[model samples]
Target: MRAQEMWKVSDGTGITVAVIDSGVKDVPGLEGRVLPGVSFMEPPVDHPDQKYPPHDDFDGHGTTMTAAIVGDGSAGGPQGLAPGAKVLPIRTSIGTPMAFAVGGEAAKGVRYAADHGAKIVNLSIGDWYSMDKIRSAVEYAQSKGVLVFVAMGNEGEGNNAANPWAMLPGVLGVGAVDENGDPLPSSSHGQDTDLSQMGGKVLVRCKKNSDWCVQDGGTSVATALASASAALVWSAHPDWTANQVARVLIQTAGAPRDGVKRNDYVGYGIARPSQVLLNHAGDPGAPDVDPLAAPAPAKTPTPGAEQTLEPRAESAAAAGLSWQWPTLGAVVAVCLGLGITVMIKRRRRRR
Candidate 1:
């Protein structure tokens, strides 16, 4: 990615990305870079003793995601791709047992971030199911000129159902790739995937301890990098609108290996922010023209049905299992496990 070389041109100054996930901790590398955002998860009914503060990370997922975007490499911590950018933490319950119950809360967080001056929103959390509230919130963010990047999910070998968030209009669905630029088998694929980024063997701030850990890779990390890439470009061109920024990213991305415009596996190909930051490549088209076309509307539920939000499965963190990692001196390796999933339950009312 040549993040350091790109930094010589623009280190993402004056850009703010909202991380809507578990929570962001005030760690060494991210000092003075995280904003005091809000939390949507209430005290879990089954676990009232647990409290989720917006700036305090319990599962370590949110903290790692935040560090990947804006960590300044303080105290030997992982250096962020866009160290000059600021992060706005919006805490949700995607990694907790209560994840299935807070779909509306996550939607509310999206609106809160957009209204609070966030230019880009990074959603590393997602589910197999879609909620009307979430769809509405994504639309609202687009209306506010906020660019949203969502993880395409990690079920490539399984069902690989398209994540509703990624399928939403105007949202960039990110996939994962290895150091050699080969697509990771775990990265979900579909028509919704917009771009790919380094997601395998990536180093991130450990959620268990202060030392750095290596993540085997998931779309979550890729989404963070993609979001940071946008921050870098937006910082360099402070006058560019969200649409223009997105257009350049799509235009300058590493071309597909088959020499085609795009593919379901890598979208427009790997995201290379340096193309815009250093080489001055890509054309920022009309500010009002969106590069990604919105998909068709989802089928509406029956008029008198009871709706509820749920998760396809519980996360490893919710099971009280710290993510597994291999130790190498002070550094360790960890698996982010599966992509977070949310499901919606609906019941027909008696006519």
Candidate 2:
């Protein structure tokens, strides 16, 4: 990707980016790039509970996005835009009900990521969360200078975008466009949309050793790409705040299409980092100003929230995998593979 080429001068070595979503797997491309993360699932407490760690990739969605954002170049997969960046994969929800409990788990996940020292947080998955909970956690991250990125929505259905959490006044909201530069059927339009798309009909690992390359259309993938873009810029300039960086991004957005300028369908335009790298775009205006944080009025809920989650017929549990750890009790359950369990070992309280 051009983003990688532009990152020659900068390395995301010290940048920690947390991916909060379905779960990330231990792909060959990301052996040591990912870190152990938390899971807030409600278990039987005393049962054979999976230690509930993050980065399991039950749906496989998180894995693909993880590769795009932080995968190191080992396998044939494209190297991440921020290859040196550390990915802190966390899980807020999974299964058919990815947005389980109205995003309670998600809010907690963001806080946990920030508390653990993630300079950039990527929410490739989105759902309605408690206003107070999400805003508070996000604000806390911002106060500490954390940059958060989110997907607008998978479908045209407009919802979570209006919320202050995923589509907060100050956070970055990402949208998707096909490789041909046309809007995808699934990308949410209006109000929540952000900019750019990479890898719609892209190759993503299905099971641990398998692969799937379909026209994956959704703001989720776009969100991760945008987050990775920010990571590239922020890693280059560690002194910039969330607002300053965001301002630069919006100000430096590239190549606008005819008949559109800053509309919700495509906020500003497709974000091209090359502009800033090449010095074609001027300085990104006021560093402390947040233009996207317009006085957004309160909004309502999405239709999907009213509907129950539809099972994709594929789950990590059916894959026959078990969670592993260096110790006896720190591993968490993994959810990915061809009905074959791949034990993922995680550790806490480092020895």
Candidate 2 accuracy as lDDT:
0.56
Model 2, 1-351: lDDT tens digits are 354346665546678888776677676878888888777754543654655567565566667677777766565564566677888887755443324442566678788888999988887654432545666677777666787776766545433122223345446667665555555556665554555544255556555436644446366666666777677677777877766667667777643444334555556655655556546463655556565655232232331111111121111000111101111111121111101211211111001
TM-score of each model, in listed order = 0.81, 0.75
TM-score of 2: 0.75
lDDT of the candidates, in the order given: 0.70, 0.56
**In model 2, which runs have C-alpha deviations exceeding 4 angstroms?**
44-48, 96-99, 157-165, 207-210, 280-282, 294-351
Using TM-score, give the best candidate's number: 1
Which predicted model would earn the best lDDT?
Answer: 1
How high is the lDDT of residue 123 in model 2?
Answer: 72
